[model samples]
Target: MENKVNRNIPDEILASYDYQPFTSTDIEGMPVERVLPTFKATTGSNKLVDSLADLVNKTVRDGMTISFHHHFREGDYVFNKVMRIIIDNGYQNLTLAPSSLTNVMNDIVVEAIEKGVVTNITSSGMRGTLGDAVSHGALANPVIFRSHGNRARAIETGAIKIDVAFLGVPNADEMGNANGMDGDSAFGSLGYALMDAQYAQTVVLITDTLKPYPNTPASIKQTQVDYVVKVDAVGDPEKIGSGATRFTKDPKELKIAEMVNNVITHSPYFKDGFSFQTGTGGAALAVTRFLRQAMLDNQIKASFALGGITKPTVDLLEEGLIGRLMDVQDFDKGAAESMHKNRNQQEIDASWYADAANKGAMVDKLDVVILSALEIDTKFNVNVMSGSDGVIRGAIGGHQDAATAKLTIISAPLVRGRIATVVRDVTTVVTPGESIDVLVTEVGIAINPLRQDLLAALSNVPGVPVFTIDELQQMAEKKVGTPKPLEFTDRVVALIEYRDGTIMDVIREVKD
Candidate 1:
């Protein structure tokens, strides 16, 4: 079946999952029927478990769905620790439903798949060896890739019912109250884990640092928790943002960042009190740096900033350049530490951050958003999922959710090492072009024809070169030549879901 994005999703696959193909991008938010979670009744003060091995034995069952969070990013240790116990305990056919999978989990997840411990899997995205394994059909079922927002929506609507949620906290009490903003392994807000804590059938809180009985200001409350377990360490804080999202010194990246700032300032959305979201990466983080100066020079202040919190963004919040930081996940240690002292840095759960079913999602209120893409087509559709070689190497993240902003700018280079970043068509469409507004590359910028108002507005901005999407594609092809078409078998490996809970595209297994 061909979706609205024109991607052919196999009918058999759709029937297996009972999911609808991408119909329209204009789907509106409706009142959601929240799925009631099954909870075991227990009245006791002794909710603490001595070890993960004991916890897994008590909570995990064969063919059950289990979940975890990626707040610790690449530094996460809880996942491997829990999975080892489950595999050793001889569990099989369990569904792995984490908020997202980080590379640190690659080896174990692959092993689990091979051993039939995790026969089913779903998450926001995957990369490295795990991605390679999934692409080659390592798991029994095709992996379901949902955006963060969609993951929250799936949980809320019971599309993904988790039997156990193994949440790793930085600080937790014996009674199960916990928070991720304290202790040595603190990685930031417990945004991704909140939904699981509330909706999972059994919520087990794991931590290295056990706080006092009450543990006030708990991000994961005692009422939501079923058990608590103390470990040696939850994760290493330093690698939380892949060793902190640092400032870029690359000249090409900086130039692209400057162009992105120019687009924001010249556009109608850049004003005294506008809201915006920006992704991570050398160029994307640099936009925050460039936007900071623009905000200072124009005497403009952003009303609020959204998405993964970064240190540069925290600097803006502390310096009063931005009024509030609505953080779902913190990207760096500085951002995580700032939340401890700054009241303005509010912690938000995944659903509240970007759930499509939530009418008042933070993403819908954005005036502008700066995003990154692996490749963008002439139609402006963005592919942040699979790379040029038809291998999964990236995540969808907020690319689709954040595209709902008034002006969504995609900042990417024209070519990356003889591979054109701009193509006639993306290898896969993660975010449809209709939602995109502008494409900012180092060589030039291209406004989506759908956004003619922006084109009229930015056409004459001095030093900001304007070009058609076709021209940018031409320049890319001129530099790198046309890329070879990827060959794939009919077997679907993964489903690229839109934030609205519809199938946007399906990735087939690459032919050997």
Candidate 2:
């Protein structure tokens, strides 16, 4: 059943589209201002609901789309509480559009699907049992997986309109001014939820701590909100960073980090006013340590550091090594605290961070960005969405968006125990080969041939060895041997869309 004709098109062509200016109008040609009535009241005197059942009965209805944010990471409780209420109320044809679905959300979502309470889902990613269930045709319709930027664009352009946004804030005022900075459940940078506050037809601020009116430095402005509901507790703050941020104690990971720092220092963009973004993993965090010492030696200071804010990145800002910290999300408690105190630590929504349709975003200003990869191909294409077994286990979060930087550096070990990081091709191409500028492993650095300027610039750098990407791939294969081919079902579990909304790749679920 293999097709003969070539349907694959060039990425540039796929990304090219006429830039049409947007007006304030809905899809049906009515003025958006008229369609969505603005709330004029300064405050609502409705008594706070005691339970989720009461909240759902007051806000949720049949065939409506509700949304939640994933700032609490693995410790999120609001999503489950809200979904259970909707299920108990017998609501059907509901679309669950959370920012992302973690392992904890899988069980309840499956039950909701079984009860016919939930049918459609759109999110940045899904993992664990929920992904497995969806892949097995658990629902009649396919799930739509979008990038963080694309989701923001979808909401603003009226493609995926939200009926209600149930925001879980750490601190809020009785008048609906809220932020993720001040209470027991504090999680910094209410970046993702800021978009929901602006676009959702109705926004309910659900918080564990409710302060008095006139909450200053409001992350969620009171003008955009319609209601405020207080709860017993939103989430456990200790679990906010959970698995997202960690310092590596593994020797192998440290070796990879050292190699990554060597690659960065030897690159052309290592001079003053350079910009970069790093992940919150063990090895990735170690890279920052190396980079910090290198910067001190070379007398270089970065203009700004961008992405999900980690405590290490925030430390750079505090130490005057980086001029600004442009944060779209916070990864740890230290970062969450810094956002509250530092005036230079600016909080921005996802659209301003990476949306391609926007006039200009922070990604466009990046000089270099250090990223992680689940699997990389000889072609330099990356797979951050699927695992070696073809299962949906990872997220697309800012990976492709930051790949558009002037220098995109991916730091990963060549192999992890038995699995090779460098394969013939990736399972899912979240980032195309053209966008990746350099690949660094523990053994050596590989400069993309397309980036001849970088290869020429780093030719004589001391203490660094450069090699062809193919040579590194061969070395890894020689050590670990080629991995067995993964078996996948024919059904498409998720569609990977580029920032421009084109189908970059499609991932099929792994066979059980």
Cα error, residue 233 of model 2, in Å, equals 0.3
Per-residue accuracy of model 2 over 1-512 as CA lDDT, tens digit each: 11111113333323342222221111122222212334445545543556656767877888898999999888788888788778888999999888888777889999988888888888888878887777666865557677787787777776567888999998888778888889898888988898889888888889989887788779898788877777788887778775345677888779878877877887778999999999887888999988999999999999999989888888889999999999899888889888878888999899898876666778888988888898888888888878777777778888878888888889888887887888777877777777798887877678889899999977676655788888888888899987778887766556666666656666665677
Candidate 1 lDDT by residue in tens digits, 1-512: 88887888888878877878887667674558888797668889878888789778988889999999999898998999999999888899999999999999999999999999999888989999999999887888889898898899999999999999999999999988888899998877889899999899999999999888899789999999899999998897767765566789999999999999999999999999999898888998999999999999999999999999898899999899999999999988888898889999999999899889866789879999999999999988899999888988888887788898899999999999988999998988999998999999998899998877998999999878999999999988998876678898888888889888888998888887
User: lDDT per model, in order?
Assistant: 0.90, 0.79
Error of 1 at 383 (Å): 0.6
Estimated TM-score for each candidate: 0.98, 0.90
Model 2 regions more than 4 Å off: 1-51, 243-247
Candidate 1 overall lDDT versus native: 0.90
Give residue 145's error in model 2 in angstroms.
Answer: 1.8
Candidate 1 similarity to native, TM-score? 0.98
RMSD of each: 1.2, 5.2
